[model samples]
Target: MATTFPQHPSTRLLRDLTHSLPMALLRTREAVVQRFRTVLSRHGLTEQQWRILRALDGRDGLEVSLLAEQCRILLPSMTGILKRMESRGLVRRDANQADGRSTLVRLTEASQTLLEQIKPEVVEVYKEIERILGKRKLEQLYALLEELEAGLLEGQS
Candidate 1:
């Protein structure tokens, strides 16, 4: 027996999944993240945790809301991530002076030390990526991605 799928109505249009902008971006993101997923897992870190740590690595106190924005995580999700990191002694949150309602977060000494230890491995992953992608092509990819993001943002407004 043969199975067949229904066809799209003539008045409707649909984009192919392989050619979808959102799906392509998601696939590309997953592919790049897979390159470093093992290293993060070995260090007992999730991708979101690593992103938050990296964002706060060399910076001063960043407000929780701002940290969420920088990490590209939602505020509700950020709170849980912060809570877990706090339990692990990887991060600490302090009351914001100017805004009493807001709290600031920064990496703890334990995390700083862990980051120092993981720095080499992280750098190696990046070097390998550049090696495989070719430095020039990688730069161009970055530029194109930024342009695409900016264009999308502009379209929203």
Candidate 2:
């Protein structure tokens, strides 16, 4: 026996209403992430590596634990990123000045130079995204996303 999908017009609309929002959001996120990854890759960076670099750029030195938190990455994964970055001379990891047990990661001069080179392109991409969405819609999107993120964090806790 063969199964039939719903043929009723109302059923189609209901299905779309129920599925389109999440599907569209996920597709949009995937597209944007792909673009971001492409940009980072050109600079010899992974998404996680970029996150670590960006964090350290804003604050030159940070504990690995704190960097992991800021990057929203697991400690093990962050350790891997740091190791690779360190090997490439993009970052330096040393015992925390005040705490021998904790490691502090800092960007190297090479990493800072790379960031300076890429900063303009990064800003241009951001501007393009905002232009595509329009300022008002972008603000609304940010608000909606912040609420969603907060709800997710609350649920996790």
Candidate 3:
């Protein structure tokens, strides 16, 4: 025979963990990112660094603050990441002409070449996702995610 503790009444009030929206989204993100992680790792880039590169791509440059916001990275962490990237010849920083107080960051020629080299693999990962999910479902997923984001943002505002 084994003794068992009684369940708390409050435990029944909470949603099941398996059905949690945030956890589901996080699980999905991790699953998807795992595929891209391999490609990023092969190119010696972290997810944050890849996000920074992608944000800067096709743009002349962006203010450090703007880049941090776009990349969803904190200002302090962005500073250190930029310093490492600059030292690695992946990025360059210059004084902002429009706003003398801010610094602007841009990808280096080497990073541009790296981006070109990595794009095919990145695209392939997207294609694989489309293949797995079916294009129609993938499009629906994108639309739903966009709608969800917009709705949440509107609620906040």
Candidate 4:
């Protein structure tokens, strides 16, 4: 005999997962990241490392906790990532002068040169996206995403 189960009321009220905002955003993110993945792979950098490099590009240095926050990397994972980056001579860590317990991280000259080399290719990827999306639509997309983020964040506090 076959059995049937009643659906939960909350489940019935839910939107289809594919059409949900978070899922849609994630799907779009995956689609966009795929394009950049090739460029990053060619440079022997992972997406997280690229984020860290960009975060540290213009600054003197940032404390480990602050750098992790800016990079959207968890503190635990940041340790391993920074360890690998330091080993590769991409970044350096110095004791934070303000706080003896904290460390400050900065990109090394080699990583700065690598960023310079990679910038043009990365810009080309942006150009390609702009060309496909059209300038106005791309701007609108950015504005909408920013507004959505701001709105959600406002509710948190």
Q: Which one is best on TM-score?
A: 3
lDDT of 1 at 106: 84
RMSD of each: 2.1, 3.6, 1.5, 1.4
- The candidate maximizing lDDT is 3
Q: Tell me the spans in candidate 3 whose CA falls farther than 4 Å from its real position.
A: 1-8
lDDT of 3: 0.96
Candidate 1's residue-wise lDDT over 1-157, tens digit each?
Answer: 8999787696257678788888988998898899788899999999999999999999877999999999999999999999999999999999989999999998899999999998999899999989999999999999998998999999999
**Which one wins by TM-score: 1 or 2?**
1
lDDT values for all models: 0.92, 0.88, 0.96, 0.95
Deviation in Å, model 1, residue 131 alpha carbon: 1.2
User: lDDT tens digits, residues 5-63, model 3?
Assistant: 99999999989998889999999999999999999999999999999999999999999
Clashes of each: 0, 0, 0, 0
Ranking by TM-score: 3, 4, 1, 2
Q: Per-residue lDDT for 120-155 in model 4, tens only?
A: 999999999999999999999999999999999999
Candidate 4 clash pair list: none
lDDT of model 4 at position 66: 93
Candidate 4 regions exceeding 4 Å error are none
